[model samples]
Target: MSKKTVELSFPKLVLIIATTVFSFTSMSNAFYLMSYAAMPWYIVAGLLFFVPYALIVSEFTGNLGQYSGGLYSWIDHSLSQKAAFLTTFLWYSSYTIWLASLFMKLWIPLSILSFGQDLTTRTASFWHIPQIYWLGLGSCILVLIVVFLINKGFFTISRFMLLGGSLIALLFVVMAVSNLILLVNHHGQLSQPMQQHILLNSPNRDYQGLLGNLGFFIFGITAFGGLDTVASLVDRVGHNKRRFPFAILIAAILITVTYLAGIFLWGASANWAAIFTNQKVSLGNAMYFLMFNLGHQLGGVLGLSSAGTLILSQIFLRLTGLVLFWAYIGLIMTIAYAPLKSIITGTPKNFWPHFLTKENKQGIASHAVLGQGLLIIGLIWLVVFSNAHAVNLYNNLTLMTNVSRSIPYLIVAIAFIQFRKQQHDYQLIAPRYANLASGLVITTILSAISFSIILPLFKAHYLESMLLLIGPMIFSIIAVILYHHFNRQIELS
Candidate 1:
């Protein structure tokens, strides 16, 4: 008799892929980035970009069935090899810069955990240097550890993603409850409708400010992607056609709700100006502070001793800090592994040089891992040592990462259009014209938004802006040049 098939349930599949795709931390950060103004944009982007993008991916994955390299595979099959290389390069670089941002963010939880501060301090001593420097140092250590683990073949991406995703889900619940307590304390009620706070009063209509918000909008869009990372595992799901779409739809809804909750809770006590005061605190750090205070409040309410409140809050805060740090490591690990594997595995042999093609005994891409790690380390150093203020530097990196990351999505849309055009035998999931039209419209809108955001950098930020705009393109160009050169050499030899 044939062995009974074992399949992952829809819920289990969602757990595996959710963290690798959407991050609550990023969604919450974007919530605070645009303050209440993010609400309308979220709705707008959700309809115009997010939902359509997900549909496009689902259609592509369904049609491509059992052939998976995620984005790289999708593009490579539909477009020229050079286009595939460039798309994958931009995709990979997006996460790499994002890794730098996360590295710098390590100090946030550390300062909160060790020093009990809401605002990240630049002055505290760690090995005789500033506290921020230690954070940078810690980031370097994390990169080294990740490289070592991947090279040693001890690393697993989905396990970390599942663990981290589960904790983030728990964190959301904790945050909601704690924020409720704080809300009751301040407002004398817990039943106030959150929708009232959704629309900002006198929203900023200026071009430059709106342009900056475009970056945050793009960040929100990024929170919805990378779901296709789990395409290879689609067949393992019990019902791919029914389950996968339901899972992603539910994930999108949950993310949207969480963003609203966070924005309303925080905005209940502070104006947009106050919320935007420091890019350093971040939504996660703010949640820590709320948790700390809520611990004390709950202890008193529960009739625990005064000392118990202090101890409980301290313990809770420390635990939160540790969990957050570990989650960052998990996320960066997945980021480091996923795109690199996708790009290399999907590309032709001659496209990448032998050095990058080398793998360890366990099939881990050792050389590629090292190269990615070194790039991240250099990026961290540049940001940490830059003359720009920490907040500006971090924000700029985020915007750059958002821009780079969205490029692949745009390419994916274009590729879908091309694929549908070339394959007349393909059954229509939706109408081909509707799909193609929406994809083009979404890509064009996103491009316009990105261009508007990058335009002012030429005048205001000058050099930093230039790097942010040109850096990924330059890297992609270099990759293309090397690919051609290698092909030429092979032909001669």
Candidate 2:
């Protein structure tokens, strides 16, 4: 066998991490939720929910270091092969939903602009010819063509995404912070302090209520979901084993600051009571309102600039998200085809098919890309037919992706705790001060929150909700059984 080689620069590595941090639609959703759930305590809850997971994941990546199969490999190495498969399965499932949700993000904003308020209400009669469906379909096609063009070359898609996404995030922060400063300066009191009090009071009745709210805060923590994409690409990072952690730390700090400032500004600028009561209001709309007010306070040009920034940011974010959706779908299709290739092509059926499964020279998997394209086409058809509520679809898709994407974190936490127990090796540097026990405790808390809050939130129907929770567990159980069975078969052969 010949040796294999890959090389990537430091700048590319940074780009990868930034793309991972900002790629998910949930980041915007989290901001919107904060506007509604505007309690001071929720910020604390967000910290508790996300920090442990991030630290644990960082430790895992540092320890694992470019191991093949990323999460699947890590889990297989630490636990059983079955556990790894289940992790990959969940990850794939989540991205599938994410792919669907990207369509919703594109559709939702465009529909609102084109059809106005009637878009949400014109359900059955309009499903066949909704503006978003056509727009989303067109966007998907455009993205796929770009992916095709970059098929044989190194694409700086991540860099472009990061630049655009960061600007949008920055614009959001500035608009929000500017509004907050203006409110405090004018009123000599925070605009919506009472609403903060109410959100905090709503969960005071029981510890569980507090815990539930804390769990709900996981929505914010998980906003950093795509970080693993960076971790997965660690091999491509120059000096990655040393510098990647620093990059992640910087990214995490940036994310937290942006989130906190955005929330603070949103509360100070808006009527918190009205925001909490009304489902129609969104983070984007809140920013727009703030700009309108700012215009009155400052002048039309400044107000228009704020408004323009918000609009431009949304447009940029959606377009970038649309591209990423195709990329993720492409990744999933690659994985899905691996099992099929082993079955049909008379390749040896084994747990790891590294040779046949490797990427081409351009980091593209030929089989996976083809498979992903086919699947995306199928999903586009489904979107055309279901004509589902765009916002609901977006929420459900985000939930689906989060649940699936979280499996790796769970695996990493379990592995980290186990390694510390078995080896007593406490030498590795962690981003935070948590010891193994503390890490495990935090992991358990976060897992419980994920199970309790995320599952219920996504469930559209009672039965579907139940299945959403139960289905992965069942799949995990089945995978364990099959792994042992296959091992025995291999032994006999």
Candidate 3:
């Protein structure tokens, strides 16, 4: 094999896709998934949504390498350009909301790194406003700094991603092994015993019934939804037809297995009841807490002094916080540039102005990158100054973004079915595989939507649901307006 092929070997390619889609930082999702303690639904969602999503993405990206426009090109070739425009817009809209949510929340890691805990809650406000005002300003500054570094190009900034990925991956590995040691010492007892009932139902007394369980199922679906972002990384794999699919399949299996194992492993050291009962252990900080608590328990296992155990735990939190801080740097840099680039390249040239689509010396879309940063800053302040509480608004944006991200994959899966049908080559995805992928995607998404309406009723998540409904309408309206305006621009030219 060539040096490039050897470097991007089967295992390394799998690791890249797995890490990209299911990062060490993504463990926050584990807490959410286990809150229901509904492992079966999570498993079901993985099979239906995640594995198939990975398969089709592998097929499209691996087989259709000639298309420069990623997701947009796939859809445009298989479906109509109008459908491609609308679908890509919806997909990019999710990232925009994500950028908005990401900036304000990025401070939590910075605060933890500096102070050994999140300080945003303790932040003093200007005037009568909440702490979000100051945090928003800080995040805007952070965004500017990240944007400056990203403008230098991906390779220049990716060193931070490498460092953060390695550190956090090692940390989570330590976490799993430490908990395994804990389980071994405890005579193989789970920290939170797996009740037979929780397999079929939510363990939380606060939510019980059809709506509650269905809501939990929907939540599981969302938890597994981020794998769509891994499509772009497939190009980096060697032997596109052979290695790419193998890599994706392995990544898909590993992601599902790891998530399932992580959910159970949390029980090795954490009593879900005790941890969830603590006011300090909210969803945002659960990943840190996992490391924090693991360090303390492992210290106890290794026979340390009280002060020594405290010190060890503090180190874990600080290390994770530091890793997460750098991870956010890489994250913001990519989210700011990659999605915008994909939308620009994936769509028709006429869909965007030359200035916005232009690349600078680094071949970076500097204008779009800068413009995205400015929009993110504006969104930060918008959330800060909103009549709704900042926390509520953040939750709303997160919920909408998760839902929005799923829609694009469903569209792509449809397009993939079309793309496969027209293919004369048998080496690509077989007709049977394409149909199976479409069937799974359609079924999973439809059920997720139909049942998701019940989630607010059980969870008291009315605001999030309202925004989830409204967010798409707004995105569609904006897409329609922009489509018409750009068509007019093309006509005028």
Clash number by candidate, in order: 0, 1, 0
Model 2, residue 5: distance off in Å is 9.2
Task: Estimate candidate 2's alpha-carbon lDDT, on a 0 to 1 scale.
Answer: 0.49
Q: List the residue pairs that clash in candidate 3.
A: none
Query: Best lDDT goes to which candidate?
Result: 3
For every model shown, what is its TM-score relative to the native structure? 0.78, 0.70, 0.89
Q: Which lDDT values do the candidates have, in the order given?
A: 0.63, 0.49, 0.70
Candidate 3 per-residue lDDT over residues 1-493, each given as its tens digit: 0011113555555654666566554455445435436567668888888888777777776666445456777788889888888887888888887887777777888888788988787757679876767777788888788778867765554455455555656766877888899999999988778777666655565445766666666767776655555454343233553566667778788878877777778788877677666677656887887788888988999899999999989988887888777767656665565566567777766668888877767666678778888978877777776767765766676676666676787798788777777753423456667788788988888778756654665568787677767777778788889988998999899
lDDT of 1 by residue, 340-369 (tens): 777776676655677887766756668888
Which has the greatest TM-score?
3
**What is the alpha-carbon lDDT for the whole of candidate 3?**
0.70
**Candidate 2 clashes between residue pairs 3 or more apart in a chain or in different chains:** 334-368
Each model's Cα RMSD: 5.2, 6.6, 3.8
Model 1 scores a TM of 0.78
Task: Give the runs in model 3 whose Cα sits over 4 Å from its true position.
Answer: 1-12, 23-36, 125-132, 233-243, 385-402, 424-429, 457-464
